[model samples]
Target: MPFMIGRAPVRRTLKYLESGKIVLKDQIKIFSINYNVGQGFKNKVHEGAQAFVFWTLPQLQYKNPDVQIVTFKNMTPSPFIRCYYEDGKQILIDIDSRSNDEIVNHLIKVIGKSKQVLKAEALAAEEKDNPANFGVGCARKCMCEIPGQIPCPGVCPLPKVMRGKYFYFKKDELENPEL
Candidate 1:
């Protein structure tokens, strides 16, 4: 049976396979930036750090115009930046006690990464194997053969007539049937 996808908004992001292809697949649109830092202390080093981030913002924006920066202040005791890629992967770096140069270097390295890392490999198809053999043991049929029916424990399941019925036909009757 084919899987049916719902029409709800929450279920829209889910991927569905239909007719040997993917449907409603998720796509990476843009990269995002989120920064959450402490509120206290207005020292020169802090200002320089902020200036460094601001300076790097345009460089990232130039590379990806759709990139956005979100500020969340006083949320934590330390400072950290989170880079969320379109492939659902994220890179989080702690900069609570780092210098301006170190922070800039980290940001540059992250920005240099290609978007190819975000996408995962395609899913492969499953092989169909014969259920009876299934590479378990010998591939020969059962030796116990019954007339007008399959052998006991054959490669396939026996029908209802072979399972419960005791009516058996002779060799000549089986060769020339008039029913």
Candidate 2:
């Protein structure tokens, strides 16, 4: 079962947005800015991914206008969501869960308006704000998997999964999925 994302996290994230304290990224669509310092850390992988699509995605595309679509490793479809079962025991059907078809739709909706250009400095800033670095420990934590020491999600109150194993984004496929 996918873990639930509680309201407290959502409230905190909304508060940040209303207060204009968010980083205002323009690249990453289907997600929000509060996912960084909000209670997102407390959210589970499924919830976090859902948050990306449900909450963060629109805000980024509309507000930031600078967000880009890059890929990382372990973005999903791994230890948690692997082969499907008919009984629906281990199936993950979150918003961020994307297949080639959905990805294509997402691209048509979000990526079609390609006026913003990617700059080196902007890339660096995006890199700086990446979940693997100052944000959450998706990719880095995966690389630093210490067996029992799950990396603490920066501000959201969630604990990292697989401790040392990093969660990454499949760059090319990010915008290719549909909702």
Candidate 3:
């Protein structure tokens, strides 16, 4: 309940991850960055890529657990980012000479979910958590409504014969065994 105090109730950690502010689109499956650890321009690019990775890696991982992130240092001649999608499609962005902020901003603009998408996701989550709502889209409806399901004892009283009190015999009945 403490976790639900200020925010909408998240049914699971996976759902919570999906509703993050910078969630990746479902199409994207992997993110790979290639940079070099050299002098001058390469060093600047390396610093930028390192900064971007340091700052955004955890967020991306948390937001999209299914997405794989790979970083290659001192392996490529220049810096670039590659995004692999579910349908065997990929998008490569050149980050050869961009600064740290520029790299972050550009990648976010190109790959991260848009503001509207985030808003819609947040609204959907709120609606799902609404106490008044029920059924499939909302918090679970009445359990008793399901076919062949037993109603909760706290919600619906058990039949007299099924109750614990019914098992106890009155003092008179106990004494008069024939009755």
Candidate 4:
């Protein structure tokens, strides 16, 4: 019988097992196939257990075109569904004793979520659109020698290309009004 394993704990345990640091024979409980299905055993086995997640590769591929990477983990201590986002954040949802339709609904909700947290802002600052100006420009000959202007040699420092006429100032130059 296959058992759900927690991702991190299982990974570490597997690594230790591979390096012969831990004996699997001594840890029989960890590998036990025995399950406690006392009261609602028949119902759980017939209903919940049979509710296996059925997802097609084509469906996932077509639905999530922007998904560059995807991974699945089965968590124990009552089955849980966990997903990792590109921002190095994880979202875990417990689906223990849930029906197949309910699990699918939860999965749909997870898939539709974007990986951004809500930012709190005052009412006065809520309508403002702040843009960043990092002094990105083309190199050009200046008629007036500005006190803090640094000339670029006919090349963009960012791309290191000679095609554009661009120049930028150092942090010190930008901060200081005088040379």
* Cα distance off (Å), candidate 2, residue 34: 17
Candidate 3 — worst ten consecutive residues by lDDT sum? 5-14
Model 4 lDDT, full chain set: 0.39
Q: Taking the tens digit of each residue's C-alpha lDDT, what string does model 3 give over 78-142?
A: 78899999999999999877776787677668888888887898898776575545477655576
lDDT of each: 0.46, 0.38, 0.73, 0.39
lDDT measured at residue 142 in model 2 versus the true structure, 0 to 100: 50
Instruction: Write the residue-wise lDDT of candidate 4 on 122-161 in tens digits.
Output: 3436644333223324132341234454555444243534
Evaluated with TM-score, which candidate comes out highest?
Answer: 3
Q: What is the TM-score of each candidate against the true structure?
A: 0.36, 0.20, 0.60, 0.30
lDDT of 2 by residue, 1-179 (tens): 12226653543354544532233223333321121122333334334444444444443344445544232334444212121223433222233434434532443344333334335645777666454352254455353354455444663345334334324555455556772
Better of 3 and 4 by TM-score: 3
What's the candidate order when arranged by decreasing lDDT? Answer: 3, 1, 4, 2
Counting clashing residue pairs in each candidate, in order, gives 0, 37, 0, 4
lDDT of 1 by residue, 55-98 (tens): 44444444344555566554554566776667777767676566
- Using lDDT as the measure, name the better of candidate 2 and candidate 4: 4
> Could you tell me the TM-score of candidate 3?
0.60
Please list the residue runs of candidate 4 whose C-alpha ends up more than 4 Å from where it truly belongs after superposition: 1-52, 55-58, 65-75, 113-179
